[model samples]
Target: MSSIQSPKKGTHSVGVARQYSGTAGRIENCQVGVFAAYASRWGQALIDRQLYLPKSWAGDPARRDSAQVPDEVAFATKPAMACEMIARLLDEGTPCAFVLADAVYGSDHSFRRMLEARGQAYVLAVRSNHTLRFLEDWSLVQTDPGTMIADLPAETWTPLSAGEGAKGPRLYHWARLPLKYQAGQGFSLWFLARRSLRDPGAIAYYFAYAPSDATLEDLAAAAGLRWAIEECFLRAKDDLGLDHCEARSWHGWHRHMSLVMAAAAFLARIGADQRRAAYGKQNETSPKRPAA
Candidate 1:
């Protein structure tokens, strides 16, 4: 068992974001989740999930003749705030490793660059249409001319399968491009190609990077781990009622979500302990003793 120290006074941060349906009768609020990661095996710890009220929610004083409607509706711009919060957490001194995120966060170049500037490693997803130059060893092509990496041609590509059955659909095709881009200096870059799951005609592209010594296989595996974050979201929503809560006000909603995250963490710990105990018992070869 590991002893808990006073929150290990260090800077480590993880940022989370959720998209809510902007429909009629739904509260106009910005729903975003942010967390911190300490230098432990578990990389992310739930810090807060907040809802910002919109200006429309503020009640009109002239409407005193009508029913009293509450003023200040919850509204938030998730992407920008999420970046700010993540930067704040990293500024606190936490080492970065393996940032797992869904496509919403992954599609943002600014967000990814923010992590990169902090010298953090990440595995983020990108939509199929994003464009990037292929990286290739152009030394053989040019004598003394300085060759730009982004203008190089793609030499190879690989398909990533992520659908139902063996023949369901192709999720994306990715290739390692050996070109140099200013944004990815000191790191290697790969081009990711994704097609629409439903309509096979649509396609997208993105660039992924890692330290120069990193291999293509390693980058793919790291990106694959992003699925774990999806599982976490499923557990939170399905088991912990992240989206079904009845809280209407911004403050109430934030407070409830925070509690739910805490409960989920506790339950996960309990489940881990039980699984470990069961595994240990099964591995033991000793015969069961008879009761006296």
Candidate 2:
């Protein structure tokens, strides 16, 4: 997770610093921030989802040189770019249970297509205005959309429960729709009734993809897994001070942020080791007194 911030007061003036300007003295006024995160999730014992900080957020207008920074590379905002990132990681043999993301990444159709193409499964949160179709037999209909293609029949949908106990109520309604957007291609469309957990009655639409055999229960579980990303963001911001660094230069900002991520990783490792030691001690002490 990454965030960009500009000066609150006024725009920065562009000029060349006297010390560095030997041949041509020109400094471009711009906004700047750090894109700090680990590239892989191995140390955390979680899925192989890396924390990518895209360059566009740092006030790079053209987003051309974003990927040039090897430590903190730029990512394409397009859905296909997201797909490419995942594909590269998977190709490198990163193991993961499922892909999870928020609505911003989830809404990208191309990204979804790429995930499916790789035989990868995901549970993503979508916005309230997404489109969907229901599963149904379309062979007998006069308009056959072709193989893997079917149309959802109009029907009244039902509200479904989201999340388990103590996490607060994140409820939604869903319908498993059949869709055929292109010729000779079709897939199951999961339509979800969108409503904020804070406001129960408010309704909207969200979409998802799954195999024909995917059950309602499976979809619900997949959607819930998206919360893991939320947990990641919270830890990054609150625990690691993700948005509080005060570096002015591009390189300086990233270097500082990388330190923070390294610290967090170190702490996580220490905590795990401590837990194992405590458990080992407990096992050693618990049953010995009875025999004596």
User: In the order shown, what is each candidate's alpha-carbon RMSD?
Assistant: 11.7, 10.4
lDDT (C-alpha, whole model) for all candidates: 0.48, 0.47
* Model 1 spans > 4 angstroms off: 1-48, 52-76, 93-95, 131-155, 158-174, 183-185, 194-206, 273-292
What is candidate 2's lDDT per residue for 1-292, written digit by digit as tens?
1223322222221111122111123323233232222222222422222223333333454332332334344544535445665677789877655565555567777777777776665656565444444344854333321211223332434456656536765566545544443311243555544434455445443345655577666676556655544454456567877546454334555565577666666766776677666654646547665655
Q: Number of clashing residue pairs in every model?
A: 30, 8
Residue pairs in collision within model 2: 128-205, 133-177, 133-178, 134-177, 134-178, 135-177, 135-178, 148-186
Model 2 error, position 6 (Å): 8.6
Worst ten in a row by lDDT for model 2:
13-22
- List the candidates' TM-scores in order: 0.57, 0.55
- Model 2: how far residue 185 lies from native, Å: 11
- Estimate the TM-score for candidate 1: 0.57
Count of clashing pairs, candidate 1: 30
